[model samples]
Target chain A: MEKTTHVTSELNINNIKSFLEDIESFIFDCDGVLWRADEAVENAAQTIAFLREQGKKVIFLTNNSTKTRNDFLHKIKSFGIDCNIDEVFSSSYGAQVYLSKINFQQKLFMIGEKGLEEELRPLGLEIIKNFEKTNDGIDNVQHIEPDHSIGAVIIGMDTSYTYQKGVYAHKLLAENPNILFIATNTDPSYPVKNGKSLPGAGSIVTMIATSTGRKPNAIMGKPEQLLLDLILESHSLNRAKTCVVGDRMDTDILFGVRGNTKTLLVYTGVTKKEELPSFEYQPQYDTRTIGDLFTLFQKL
Target chain B: MEKTTHVTSELNINNIKSFLEDIESFIFDCDGVLWRADEAVENAAQTIAFLREQGKKVIFLTNNSTKTRNDFLHKIKSFGIDCNIDEVFSSSYGAQVYLSKINFQQKLFMIGEKGLEEELRPLGLEIIKNFEKTNDGIDNVQHIEPDHSIGAVIIGMDTSYTYQKGVYAHKLLAENPNILFIATNTDPSYPVKNGKSLPGAGSIVTMIATSTGRKPNAIMGKPEQLLLDLILESHSLNRAKTCVVGDRMDTDILFGVRGNTKTLLVYTGVTKKEELPSFEYQPQYDTRTIGDLFTLFQKL
Candidate 1:
């Protein structure tokens, strides 16, 4: 395992104060950093309020594509945190912005849920409609020939993922090499309400990747630059002064490292204290929980 | 990229005569060698007929688990080849034999088609039935706890593979580390009627494997020792006098090498003339077609 740099000491008042002073905006990963599933972490609400009180921009960037932006805002507000729909930046939203920026004019062959479809609706993007309406209905495995009009294939968290969908995506990629293949996120699994995690879009993408022999041209999620770019485009944030806080090292901390922003690792999520040594790129600061940063906020 | 031993000479009359005299039984891969998908190669039927007339025991071995032994026999007969159901050995049959050998008495969690189920019927193995009767029906995503009575999870080619099936398999494996995870074959794709191939058992098994983070305990198919063991147990053949013949090196040819049998490579299928040098275990004999082996039979 590759060794990564580690912050040996716990962030106390002086360290927290300095860290807080250096950053103007805070980007948070929701599932692990803010709360586990639906239950919020201790002092999670307080930490966000404190950051807002200091006039720091708080952005909740999540890779959960199952829900729409409004759904996330509702969930966050339900947790007693002041949030706006615009403050919630999901991978689906990032993909919509990206497609618009590239001026993609072709129809998208979508293999996701209504949330993803809803995201595309705002952009006026046309979609190759699904054959099946619901899981209860027939999969009309129509043996449909490859459609040249379909220039892109987008996939997210789809519970109704079927063989037909995979076959169609494979056919499109096989027919045209230039067809854009984009995935919302590739997180292997996501935590559910019961503490157990379910297979994420990454698994679905992997299945299609195995069948088509083509990887996604772009993964519009954390660790990738697109999500960060989406955040930067919407908010005026100084990269040098911004800090990204998350539990997972691979997606969260690596996202910060790739963007050249400060990163704070919280131990309440996927990453553990013992596993920090094996990381290839360590975060800049380590704390027990997101609430631990409150001591620094108090010092100010 | 590993260099394997290669036989550079084409088998003429003398070489074929000697090769024929040395092998009492011939194990053949059905796809690519004897036939390509449904159509038999130019002289495949004639070669098999000649071998049978010479009193050689021929086995039609395939990894395709979609069809039963009777189905294979019917197809072979349709191709004008003399064959019996007893001569056909599919991966589904291999799994049945393996489970019987291990005295697997517990219920099996089956993720395959009717062909695989038919193979298990003779052994009196009970299966934890799937929730959905068809692909259009509800997946039943039943949150059934791990049933300790289930000892093995067998997977083959299933077009109706769903997220619920993957989740259930993962849960079963997670609940019991000792439970057997058996896959029919891991061939990424298999040839269909149109010369195009569809995702095979390997892809479905891979999806479950990815979600479970556990590789199958046993993969009962070509390239694995279990398939060769099943063939040897059913037939009276001397290892020194047996020749395994096929087109693909990774599965068919490798099976022969691992079983300590001589192998004959045919160029009528997947492995072409240019691919011989790159194999890690090259066949001992090379021929343009199965009909080329007739030169030895003529000498007899």
Candidate 2:
């Protein structure tokens, strides 16, 4: 990989080329820029192929905590893109890393689905269901009381949401306000097929936070510096070389900008073209569309 | 009713007695103190009966926008309490009063349900329903756009929520940014049969405010002082002799304290027993429970 250092206060075409030269590793956001609503961007496969040919490693990063790395890899491969499970990083995995580093010892009360449980199980974390039900005699469980032995409460999207879950989370949160309240991401809505959408884990997290007078300790996803730091540490790469590409400015572009990496704002995602000027912080490169990625790669 | 005034900063039994003696009109809050999880308070019926015998005027004041005055009266009567529709005041009703006073001429783009419509329709206000169905491509209406001619956008809880509504609201908000965004209440959650619930209008209203970067022009509900002013204006009652009795310190008691009415905190609502001392503005009377209201009346 070519090593070049270029810095400009604003986005320019030359800086984009300089970024590609210096960065041996590329982190691409999946939801909006690569594939939106169920359809992959026209140049997604070509861009990935060009990156592989250039001897540059590509990692698919997603804040969608609903899917596992293997699941994501399978989905990407089906879209005519080649990626292994190890090349994909999800917020659920990042959350697991966060939990392992903390000194929580209580039974983990999770407000998430199977993907989250799959991530936390290997850490020897005990899952406690219905803390309120167990305490109120509605259900029988060994751990009825909340004490130091209770580890932490993790929140994420659960399609099978119930009032009991909220009640339990509220009670556990109230008991130990210091207990870890970790959420996967802060995205309020997730894109669905047929132009429909569902409230993401962040909405539930907000509800819990508002009910209890506490905020999450850490959000293990994009826009949070922790995940970027972890990726950098694992790859043994400096921030100057890595280029972050995504569709949303608030989350993806923000991650790159704040992480001191070259940021590319692709037009194939959640954010619209008209909303760019209003942003306080602009991205390093503003491509008309992600289809231009192949043209830029050819020029480079 | 006694017209005794005790101007003492320190709270004592003598002052509490004096304050209680001066209470001719009583304002009660719904949800928590009146009922907990669909169960009416044990003394609710008897207390209302005793107040009626004393020939004291009573009003049921609530920040809950889900029900109309008739709905509340019916619900209260179902719970074995005698109450009139005229004696109930809601934030929706307050919004109607505010809108009528402003003399807005154009049709209203309402983001609320039946209760809100019922309150606004009597004032000859035209309710714009097409904003709610923008996704269906029903663009027959000439004034589809939310402009200066489109008087205001009234926001309240609507079970029929959609992204299309959000988009239309955003469009109107972006165009007129000055167009009124009136929210019914700011309570983040409402007590349900199970526990505290989400999808409250407060969350939706907050989302719109955060997205548009503008606070609503006014919140016509408890704690806003608008509703209190309306109550006093309609009933021709003096704030000095009016006692606001409710379970929530933040909403009911805060209103009373700010409006210069005698505030009473009943320990049967959103606030717990231990949380009273932490409040910056204290209530005049802190009863152990709503049952103590009868005892307070007896003492007076």
Output the number of the lDDT-best candidate. 1
What tens-digit string does per-residue lDDT give for candidate 1 at B141-178? 32434567788999887766666666667678765789
Provide the lowest-lDDT 10-residue window in model 2 chain B.
B134-143
Query: Which candidate ranks first by TM-score, i.e. highest?
Result: 1
Predicted candidate 2 versus true structure: per-residue lDDT over B1-300, tens digit per residue: 122243213324455455546788888887777777679887888778787787677888988776778888888888788898878899998888898888776778777767888888888867874443432211221123454466677777654544345545645665575687888987765555455344456755764564455678889888889988888888988888888888887788788878888877777777776786667777777676666656655665
True contacts kept of each: 0.28, 0.02
RMSD (Å) of each candidate, 1 decimal: 3.4, 8.4
**Superposed Cα deviation of residue B277, candidate 1 (Å):** 3.9
Candidate 2 structure lDDT: 0.71
User: Per-residue lDDT for A114 in model 2?
Assistant: 73
User: Interface RMSD of the predictions, in order shown?
Assistant: 4.8, 10.3
Q: Model 1: per-residue lDDT, tens digit, A1-300?
A: 323455545678767777778889999998888888668888898999989998899999998887789988988888888998778999888888989989998889997777788888877767875754333211223244557788899988776676666667767875578999999998876566565655667877877777667889999998998988778767978888888999999899889888988888899888998997777778888899998877566765
Candidate 1 DockQ vs. native: 0.38
